[model samples]
Target: MNKLRLIEMIFFLFCSLLSASQKPNILFIIADDLKASVLGTYGDKVCKTPNIDKLAEQSLVFDRAYCQGVVCGPSRTSFMHSRYRGSMGTNLAEHFKNNGWYTARVGKIYHMRVPYDIINGTDGQDIASSWTERFNSSGREAHTPGDYECLNLNIFTDKLEHRESTKMPNRMFVSVSYEGDGSDQPDYKSASKTIALLNEHKDKPFFIATGLVRPHYPNVAPEQYFTPYPWEKIKLPTIPENDLSDIPNLGKSKIMNTNNSIGKYIDNQKKMWSAYYATVQFMDEQVGRILDELERLGLKENTAIVFLSDHGYHLGEHGFWQKENLHEEVTRVPLMVYLPGIKAGRTSSITELVDIYPSLTELLGIETPQEVQGKSFLPLFEQKNKTIRTEALSLLTNGKGYSIRTKDNTYMRYKDNSEELYDMNKDPKQFNNLAKNPEYSQLLKNLRSQLDLRLKQEAVTIPQKIKKVMIYT
Candidate 1:
């Protein structure tokens, strides 16, 4: 070959190698029912989440990230498909699988009501086609042997047989601190499995999603986790006496009213809070384990990590204990992204969970599917001052109620036409409602118009085949 031709060939090969090496691995970590306010990184005073807080330091923390849905199934479905709640399509993992990347999910990625699905080691609403491989962690927490005390149900397992058939409210407060270490927990297994996957796929371009189930219902954690926060030191959330008085009847129904069962018993309430916080810390340790493995395997630099919750949880906020309301506590989630070269800082820009699909695709130079409805916030990674969205919308009760959160306000319009407006600038806690005030009539109208337009744009007719794929047992 001629000398000039050889030089050109070497240059072309070099460019190809550089481009191939630039393609990043994706590590998506999602937690269940973990709210933003409870984490140390998000300014929580009670819970000690050293691992997640460490992650926040090396990541770009999102200050106002909202989920598309209030509940697990719909919220997971929306973000996974990169569309609104009612839209239909394949999930993010499946899209990656089709694009020549190995994708895997460990633990609960879709909506599996914990303990039930954990016991069976089954996929609840997961899209089987999305994953190249999947693993479910079955632990002792799923079926606690006769020693644990369940405060919410007012039953000790030792006193009862056949715990599976025990009937309780869906929002019943349940908690237990097990006698053993966290090694037997499903989340612990999930972290170990994820670490194994990382070691196995270190050389290949891959997408690994680890879903940590903790701080969810039946709030159970190891005894060591519970020891950090004693019940006596646990602080109750400050609540106004007439908190629900201004709320409409529709809104009142959405708030958790069953707290009366455990309200009078302050010790029980403290125990529940302690359990939830302990679970958060336990989950944080699992996350630390996975992240440590990534760094140890030398995959940290090339892999992009996106950490967030499916939706926010309410721990006695707004007189509500569990999620399924359009309030700020239930809608706002903790979202942090770590790209290779992006500067680490917090951004106040409003964002949605659905935005994750496009942002990751854009960052990795992957072609996002045309059906995706979320806008990529990749620009914010470079310029944190820039704003990609004016507001974020969250659907509740399958669209029976919805909320629109803007920088200065949060507006909710129920299916019954009852309305609520909170001036976030003045009432950050969302205690006072301004919807009935005559002075803000025009402002309310404009927000309503924007919400209606958004709903129209996101609406999609679900195909039967897609619907079947979305159905989870």
Candidate 2:
């Protein structure tokens, strides 16, 4: 080879190595039971979430992001694998670890039932092979102060005889605001640990995921968070009389019937709403602290940050207190992605949690596993107006009930042959069910066909038993 030709080749090789080494790190932050409508950027008039709102300003906010499952375990398992739950055993962090990046998890990345898992510091269905290192936050928040009282039950710091367990049905509708500094909270600890990890891994390409477990249950937060949302200012969701009359049997089955008694008391309802909002703001503070640390470390410009919830939450919406429904309140979550150098704004294009995997892989130039069922939405980053999928699907009741959300409507089908259809544009609150109307029969038929096709395309196959006779030979 000539001297000039060899030197040119060497220069190109060095540039390629430099570019590969400078790949951006990924910081994934997920919240538990956080709905999209409660944030300041999502048209929330009451909640004060300045830090989260700032992040939203610099992120490509997905206005219609839906989860694959209505509950935690299924929704998290679905998105982590980039496929429907039970489709294939794939771990998102493990995938990144297998590639060149170092992966770590802090707090509840998987399905850890709050208060139970947090109290015991248990590894609830966590993918062991996914993380290079993992930490669970165990703090005073898990063990409640004894003096707190709710309409349903009382939490005694010291275990009391005859006092009901915190998991009682009636307790789900109550919220407790602790009076003290939040330094001892598990979420606070998780944020501290995440910041340390970021500082430690700042020089290397790392994938650090932090999960905040608040606003999920036991609706407890620091007193400061609750001060902003006074009971007088709390607005209860408007529920029409006989709201459940038109709902199908399958749809009604998911509703928490036990909370109906608590819902009757208007003051109790307002207090519960206030508590939920307070907890959300507390969680947002932790998010801000972590983001601030990332910026302080000078890694903000090169790091790709993704913020989302495992699934949405319900606070008296549809007369429901918690998740486990196929309704929009429980299925649609807040999702935001901030990529360096990309124009930040909002996009109404419907997106799914499963789409997260392929989008990240494509953005980082990593090879995605063949088992992933979601399509890459990286195109939406460049062209905010583009539509990736026509509908977002969510499974409920072990796949017995399913919901399909399109641009203009939401259609739900139950295993018992009952159905529900809503025109989102006309009735955003989903107050009026249009399924039984004769005028919408054709539209319902088309939606059902589309839902069936989508489900078939995303179905996961169960493994069959192997024959024993052939092994003997």
Candidate 3:
């Protein structure tokens, strides 16, 4: 070889080795539409998630982790950029990629719509700059050649049939018991692709994100996984008939007042629960497979694993079915971080999804960008009681709703001038709305003031040279 060519090759190899030695690989695995309440590590009395629970044993589990947006698009955009939905900034993976790290994403990272995006095989509102390489796993979704059924409507599709139309609205509520081992599922493909990428990029300093779409919509999982969650075994708490009465009209999800037959309500609830549990179990298995691969490749010791959900979902809570409502079930998500040398611990410290960006940068000794709005909770690894923030703030799209979650209370305000206040410490279930009660008048006043001030502080001007903006569909 010529002298110049040999010199260039040597220089490139040295740079690669230097980056690998100085930086840690990041494995960020986030589940779709998953609530913290269903996980075994999060005090779930029913679900058996051996893989994720085992991960919790080696990680720092945050019990009070919340999301900024009530729905997927805004919530994801908010965290991916490490800023509020209306603000403009560089996304998490893009930041690392710009700093000479190989960043890639597999499956649903940003804000892909569940069944629609999965069925059409499109990247719904995905930001292009976030990764060096990005992948989207397309499955038939509701038409995944399975035993499909719409529990509420008693509509059933044969296992041998494909969907008549992808535009079916009820597709989101349908559940499918796949006939095969689930290799055709999006999440399965995502995991397999993620494993492949890990092997190919094992030598480089990398930021790999694995987004698993399960327990999301169409609730497709293999028949073997469904065996553990039979309808007879599916259990839902008996909530009061008046449980949803106090919630304002704008604060309730569309599923809360569906037109389904009353006779099939309880049966449908159980069926939905059964499918969700089965899908969650299936998702956990994928996590186990990826972790095993990371260990087999000897990457575990040099990698930081972060497992979380985009936002929580309502599993028949107060007759609510999906997300988009600013309630505890839809706001509080699961967050677990596994840094190499830190011992496993659990904390109730209030955390938000936006915090992940800054925290990851801090843990890896990287300089956080000034535009990032999140506060780092890195101190909580050793000092569990460290106060990262006195309160966590969450909101609905376009500021339709605002919630302030403090240690003692959860105060929610809607655009219609209606309010709901629950003593989070004393009333975890939120059955009682103290907003109408005169006894807690003073407490309500203080919370409202806090929310107002917090909102003003969070509002910021977006940079004029923003590359792209995705409207939440």
Candidate 4:
């Protein structure tokens, strides 16, 4: 062997040994349908999230973290892969597992259909390569004996009425205040199981991802959780008449929303808000439970903690009931990281969820793949004002193309060649669509060009069935 090659091999061996001994444990916590605006640390006055607020105090909070996809499945898949929808690569957990690290998943890490998947106690889309071990937290969603209320139908009963069919039950709105200590809920079980796993794998270098599902659907929580949030005290967001007039058909949700109802949203608006807040509070408490266990085990100092949501939710913003839109309410997610050596800080710099995998690898001094598209923004922890990217791109589901968000404006384009442009500074609510106006024609063209360039650069992920192979027959 050459002298230079021998020296390189020695150095590589040194790094591998050093990393094996010194790398800290990774604790990744993700939430479902959690919007950035609703958290107490993120400036919500009414919602109670004391545990998450405490973590935020000791973490580096990203104020403008956007998700790549708006819905649960696509959004989770995009971030975990550190790539766009059309692009695929090894997932974050799988990457660590490949590096001789003990990685595990304790809940909804990958796509799990809400309520349905929980009811079945199975997640079919989960990538097995991502974990050394995995577990699911199951619960009887709406069927659990409780104080059930179909607010839209003006039906209030301790038990769900017989008229509600078994098929697609609780697919729409159903708020249930159950009689329990909240231990039976899926999120609580997940927290408890995570605590158990920490005890089991405390000695090894581990990458543990616990995805907590709450504030996502059915709005079910313990009766005690509901006590804090009163219906009379809840304040609903302002909904202007004909709010969907300016929005193109592609911008609206074609599928059914969990909160969508025929009418009578007026009388139940306050109750709906109260129920949603209760679910969030319940979710926050589970986080506290996990945090307490971590600190008790003396692993807090050496554990790097990350908290994020798959995507943001719409609480009646722009007359939108749920996610699947490209608006700020749907795309902007809550993101925070707590590393042991770095001092906690917050930044307003634009970031995407896909950047998370790259950032973690960079911070840990690990070698990352060249195919990964996300830019490492660990430097943002040191310099809060620095921006790694000018715009964040998010994919819209159905046939609706995509949306790109910048500091000043948001540009959205549909598959049908239609567009919607909003001047974010003037109309933060996004009630007015300025794409038709001739005054902003130049600005629209520039954004369109940017989107076009991004699409051209991205490698497509076509099915392998059609790929050509040598004719062996």
Candidate 5:
């Protein structure tokens, strides 16, 4: 070989060695019911999410990511298995376990309580034979365990049959507000368990899941978290009396229910907002604790970090308290992805969440499952702010509403076939609905067609054929 060619060959091999030695670590952090606009970087104005904000600055932030379903169990289950809504069939735990991933959850990953749900060291909600090891921590208290109300307020109450302010159903041992150490309690437990797992498998690869239960309902956090924004300094959302007039009958029925009196008085909006921010602050601190360990152990470069929430929460918006309604505030979430070899410090308008399955596999150069419905967002990561998805879809079975959000338009389809369309560009708050406007009939038709395409593309799980046994000759 020529001398010049030899030198070029040596340099090529050197570059290959460097690339081969670097493999990113993965740290997936998900908040319970966080909204996109609540973070400091997302123009939250008051709520502080410094840890997540830092990640957002150095990672790819998805401005349009959404969950498969608005409810907790179904939404989380779909994302956990990376399967589309129709494909999950209420068996996400089983599907993920069938895959070759070693899954272990510390807290409320599968919509169940701690030690109570982890009876005999295993919760039946968890895939029976999937996890190599599992740990359940029910914390220290039960829901309304004998009626203790130190931070109870009228505005933050839910009208459900619970004795406490929130409406979540309570069981004998597993109830709301399980006692232990509050934020410091479960946050540390989850972080410590994850750290131990990372240390044990530093040389090998493993898939570990840690679930944090804060900023959900019963938004109880340390008093110190409230120091940043005093009640006087905080600004509550405006409640327009005519907000419902433009909405369709079906939309109004879904948003305003007889039992949703928790947010009746708009005057108490400040207290609810304060509780949300405090919970966010507490959740942020917990996130910092976990990330601190990852940084100290030098896992950031090799591991891919994905931070997301199940869905957004409404803080006195359209007279709603929790998710299950179709609104930007209740449907949008903050999603940040940090993969060392991939892209960093970028922003993508592409829809995220439930798409994690195909996206992660694509980033790692692997083939996606046959039944997965989410498209690979790797292309969008490479091209920041470019349109990966023309429109986004969110579904709710109880409300029978399928919401579609685009860059400039927001449309909702009700079970009764009534529609509510909002030109988000003109009204980001979504105070006005334009579905009845005859002028935009063409635009509505286009959006409806797009929804049809998505629905058909992701409708149901394709049945698998069973193999027959061959007889011996």
Candidate 6:
């Protein structure tokens, strides 16, 4: 070969070697109850999320990612364990620790109280036993009074920390909030601990779960975070009065009336919004800090970062305060993956968070646990803008409810066997319920049958022999 051709070949080989030697670092950043559209990249007219916007610009954003459940605890259990609701059984906590991963957690990775949630306090109960190392940063709520308080359930009639306690709309009032060195807040502390862990474990491949507990509820933030957005500039979510008319009484009751700010529907909407935005901004800053540390320590090229929310929240949309509805606002969360070799600035409207576990395993070219219920999105990464799941299912408990969200339609099925279908493209807000319309009855029936067939396939129990083998592994 000539000298010029040899030089070109050598350069090409060098570039390939550079890429092959570096394993992508994972910076999985999750926001609590965050909506995708609330960020500037998602076209939020009023909100400013420069860090998230930058991340989104350089990453793949899933526009149609839906959670298995809307609640925090169970939603997280399924996400972290990489199992669908039916497949998770009740032992999600044990499955992680038993599996081969150096699972260290700093913040609310699974389901626990804010401070206690980061640690292991499920208010005398326990979080999922999924971590090889757990750190507790409890007791940040007392720093600022009247923000949100962690009420001791001992003063109440029941332990009240179980899923049953969250059956009603007012259940949010039970938890408390904290304030302080803002930097020393439990969530912040969790981030700080994560930086230290990353520094300590730079040599080994580890799974570090960091959960941020801001913008979830009790919207507590230090005064500094509140400066950018004045109360007067904040805009309230638009909701028509008749928004609840189409929804059944049972569905309406299950959703909280979140139009009011703070407790008892505070009249000052602007003040409440300021608090919420401040909390989100604070959380974003925390995310930036961790990312900075990851780069500073030269761990960015070796780790893989996956960021998501357990579920989305309703910031006064449709008069709802929290998740637990089939509405788009409550169902859509901010999900982004920053893998170094994967193409950047790509977005897909794929369905289901269950797909994340399989996707990660495929990206790393490793075998996923036998218990995983998700399919990997590696195909989409290779073939841009591809569909992962034909339909994503969301379940609402205590009411025998289920929803199937496809590319064009959303069908909600209730316990009484009544069904509602919406054309999401035309009626994005889901203001129209076509289930009862004679013209669409056949469509509804067809969707219901599809749901049933899918459920039956998912419901089949795993063989005990496999379980035994998995247990010993």
Candidate 4 worst ten-residue window by lDDT: 464-473
Model 2 residue runs over 4 Å out of place are: 1-20, 152-167, 253-259, 460-473
**Highest lDDT model number:** 3
Output the better candidate (2/5) by lDDT. 2
Candidate 2's residue-wise lDDT over 1-473, tens digit each? 44334334433332343345576689999999899899999999999888889999999999999998788887887899876655364568898999878899999987786666787777777888999999998654424653343543333333333333335555555455666778878898999999999999988889999999887776777778888888787888888888877888777634343436654566766777788888889899999999999999888878889999988877777777678778888889999998766678888999999999977876676788888888776666656768789999998845588999999999999988798899999998888889999999999999999998987788543334311111000
Overall lDDT per candidate, in order of appearance: 0.79, 0.79, 0.81, 0.79, 0.62, 0.62
Off by over 4 Å in 3: 1-20, 159-165, 257-263, 460-473
Tens digits of per-residue lDDT for model 5, 169-285:
322111132233453355556667777777776654445567766676555555566567566666767768777777766565332323344345443455557766876887787
Please write out the lDDT profile of model 1 over residues 1-473, one tens digit for every residue.
44335334433432343345545688999999999999999999889999999999998899999998787888888899887754466578998898878999999997786766786788887778999999999765535543455555555555434443213443346666667777888899999999999999988888999999888876677778888899899888878888987887776534353435655566767777888898999999999999999999988877889999988877676667777778888899999998665568989999999899977766555678888888877666656756778899898754578888998999999999999999999998889999999999999999999888877776443444454223221
Off by over 4 Å in 5: 1-24, 86-102, 113-124, 128-130, 141-184, 252-267, 341-343, 460-473
Error of 5 at 453 (Å): 2.0
Instruction: Show how many residue pairs clash in every candidate, following the order shown.
Output: 0, 2, 0, 0, 15, 16
TM-score of each: 0.91, 0.91, 0.92, 0.90, 0.81, 0.80
RMSD of 2: 6.9
Q: Estimate, for each residue in 1-473, the C-alpha lDDT of model 3 and write its tens digit.
A: 44335334433432343344567789999898889999999988777799999999999999888998877777777888777665476778988998888999898888787777887778887777888999999998776676888776777777545443345656656887867987888988999999999999998889999999888887888888888877887777657877778988887776653444423577777888888998999999999999999989988877889999988888677777788877899899999998775678998888888899988776665678988988877767766766777788888876688898998899999999899999987888888889999999999999999988887787433565554444333
- TM-score of model 5 vs. true structure: 0.81
Using TM-score as the measure, which candidate wins?
3
> Candidate 1 at 163: error in angstroms?
4.3
